[model samples]
Target: MSNRSRPDSAGSPRGSDEAAQGPGVSAGTAPVGTVLVVLHQARSTPGRIGARLQRRGYGLDVRRPALGEDLPQTLDGHCGVVVFGGPMSANDPHPFLREETVLLERALARSVPTLGVCLGAQLMARALGARVDGHREGVCEIGYYPLEATPAGAALLPWPDHVYHWHSEGFDLPEGAELLATGRTFPHQAFRYGMNGYGLQFHPEVTREMMAAWTERGAHRLTHPGAQPAEAHFSGFDRHDGAVCRWLDAFLDAWLAAAPLK
Candidate 1:
């Protein structure tokens, strides 16, 4: 019943004291002890999440922990972790997938507060042993859609109740994991496991350009046999950039105030 794939990365390994110990890291301008952003693939950057944290005077660390990347070990040095989206499926036969999930598991164990988007979210679910698979119909939903956060999701609010969408696979809420939101197509739009960790099926951090960037790479998914692109009425992202940032800040503060890992 241990909810994790890689137990080794249980929590932030290098404490806040050691956060400044690393050499030649990408070194995002975020202050020391800000937050860690885990990139699943090159495409899935932190998006608005990183922008928000930087403005808040909090340091941001980007790492591909799945690729066995280095530095800023452990949750003690970070305010939180954000896992960005990716084209990869959670079930892919990649050892790095397992390793990434284990890191997420460790974050959960220490209540370090982690956020996973799309594949990032799926991996969170997978690490916790929930179901993660592609759409049988292969109906990969690109573009925007509304997400109705459940009561649980509201608890973590400033949530919009109805938000954006961008994934094909969905998950049944894992045991003790709160189903925070639901999309029309994907029942498991978002969830909160325990108190701090979050798994979101949607992409709240994406900008209009980022969305376009996504479409450029995965454009095939738009016309993928029978897939649906963002509707003509779908508009685009603009306002949510600030909103998601504020929400992320609150999430970090709440997690930190409740669990002091200094």
Candidate 2:
């Protein structure tokens, strides 16, 4: 399944699945399970997503295509696929990125659960045949921004009034997909394909440490430097973690329940 892969309930000891099942673990409960994680950038971390899934008992098989690592096996038997944020453009001279999206298309085809954040959302849109480009805003959106959930978005994600934004690129809603959220500059803040897939242009996976790391690494892009200076912004987060992860966890729980085990 991967260069390094294993599984147990996320809350249990790594090797306790088989021993505790008493040989009655059905076909659905494979001892070695995983959730394929596509790391789109150097800094993207799986904050609440990992925490939530760990509570529900699932492990991750991280795939860092940007770092030259090959993608793990398909989403079958895996809990789901989570694509993280990054600075690279999905359309910027890269095959691995496109390849990961193609794999996402396969996930969609099979109704496998997937959650894409920031650049991950754009790539997921592209994979679903949407038109994505950066020329719309022409400026980097580097902090917390507002989001308006559509009727569908409301039903699906129940997102708060505002969410964070960290990318310059945006996408046109793809065919057969529903737009979930929008902002002043980007109409495609979030999207969904069926019940099992989600695309979020904001960094819902970002925690305090992750945000601090991102700010530090991207400090070069910031001109001003001071306490609460005109640039650094994390004050608007508003603890929307419940709305964000609730919908995502629902997707993971439903799709993975039906996941095919090899």
Candidate 3:
């Protein structure tokens, strides 16, 4: 069956079904195959990533473990999974964080098409026995930063020169993972584990509304060394958003096509 025509499974929650249908889907249409979406905050939306998945005829099964929602024991009922960025660090001692780490481990082991962004990326790295920590110099990448795709990355897809970022910590390239992209401040910008698991330190999923919300709500983070001013964030978005959007579209297509590791 086509991805859109597949019936919704038990993995997808009722609220997520409505959210995924949005205005494009007919009221009586059968729900699509679900992509498990893990968010850190209660109000966190998957932003452009969620929209892209819906456009591809995949429904989102959003769950916020931080707010006490349980993650699935397995990814069998889902076509893919995405863990979005948040203010929390992957190194935190929270039980939910540990649970997410375990879930990521399972995703990778099953060779499920999985994506982890920012803290999600860090968590993936941590699950793979890599370190997730801040720069010793105390620098932050709270704005657009240049991204240099590695040879392996360029072979897979074109990458944006500058990408949106909103994190204080970065992850080390995990063992057995191929480094896909790099940046000066945080050298390990993106990596891939096996055939189906990917991690991105930048926020390609952020929308204009999400960017505004982040800059305003995370205003204090702008004061940190290496962070751009709020005005720069808007100006940078205007300058580079088109490339990022195009890159995200191509990347998602490639991501979904990835085969399970043999």
Candidate 4:
């Protein structure tokens, strides 16, 4: 990552002026804009999603409020915001978690391009006045699982043959939100709130490295009650890699083009 690309939270609440330039200043040159990537843990880097955005000329300021860094008060200079998953639940009493939800509220209300992955999706749901809690009893999906897109989902998004899942908690559909996809174990797999805000319950941003790190650390959770082994999550990566990457690229390109950060 370039020094200007990955801004940390140590110095200031807001990033440097250079890091605040919004996206698409040039067609094929270096990325001129910045995207705020809210990371919950060190291991959960933006991975392939971040890489794609960078290739499209978007710099990333990856922040971790969990480490006592303050989140920016506004999205004035960011083209988009993406919150990655974590082991922590959105319902936790931690102040940082609450702040994350508040940030999501601001992002959605302002119509900034917003994406939430897994636990981040739960936070987005909470921000939108939805219930976020544990999955139904006897259902804990932890590996690659099938996602059935709704009619609306089929129309709006590409259908990945299967998406990777690791969450034990699921979200309820927020008021006025459209359910884009569903799973057998967890009904709410993906949703869209308003024009620019999206919440995905699966890890579309996962790369081989991120998956290895997660499985290595979360090995216990894989075989715990109602879960599959770690290998199940990765074995089909070879088969699913092409479709998944294409889907993410197309989805993100369309998403950014629809309503870029103002």
Q: Write the per-residue lDDT of candidate 1 for residues 1-262, one digit (tens) a residue.
A: 0112111211212312112223322455435456787765433446555665555455667887555675354567676777766555688777777777777888888788688877788889988889887656656555556667577667766565445555667777787788877876667877888777778777666555555555555555566533445442144445344565466567656655555423
The positional error of residue 35 in candidate 2, measured at the CA in angstroms, is 0.9
Q: Candidates' lDDT values, in order?
A: 0.61, 0.62, 0.79, 0.74
TM-score of 4: 0.86
- Residues 99-119, model 3: lDDT tens digits: 999999988887888899888
Model 1 misplacement above 4 A: 1-32, 65-76, 225-227, 230-234, 238-262
**Model 3 Cα RMSD, 1 decimal:** 7.6
Better of 1 and 3 by TM-score: 3
Tell me each candidate's TM-score.
Answer: 0.75, 0.76, 0.89, 0.86
Q: Give the clash total for candidate 3.
A: 0
- Per-candidate clash tally: 13, 1, 0, 1
lDDT of 4 by residue, 19-85 (tens): 2222333655655578899976544467667767776777788899987878998888787999977
Report the Cα lDDT for residue 38, model 1. 74
Weakest lDDT window of 10 consecutive positions for candidate 1: 1-10
- Best first by TM-score, ranked: 3, 4, 2, 1
- Which has the better TM-score: candidate 2, or candidate 4? 4
**Candidate number with the higher TM-score (1 or 4):** 4
| Model 3 stretches astray by more than 4 angstroms | 1-25, 260-262
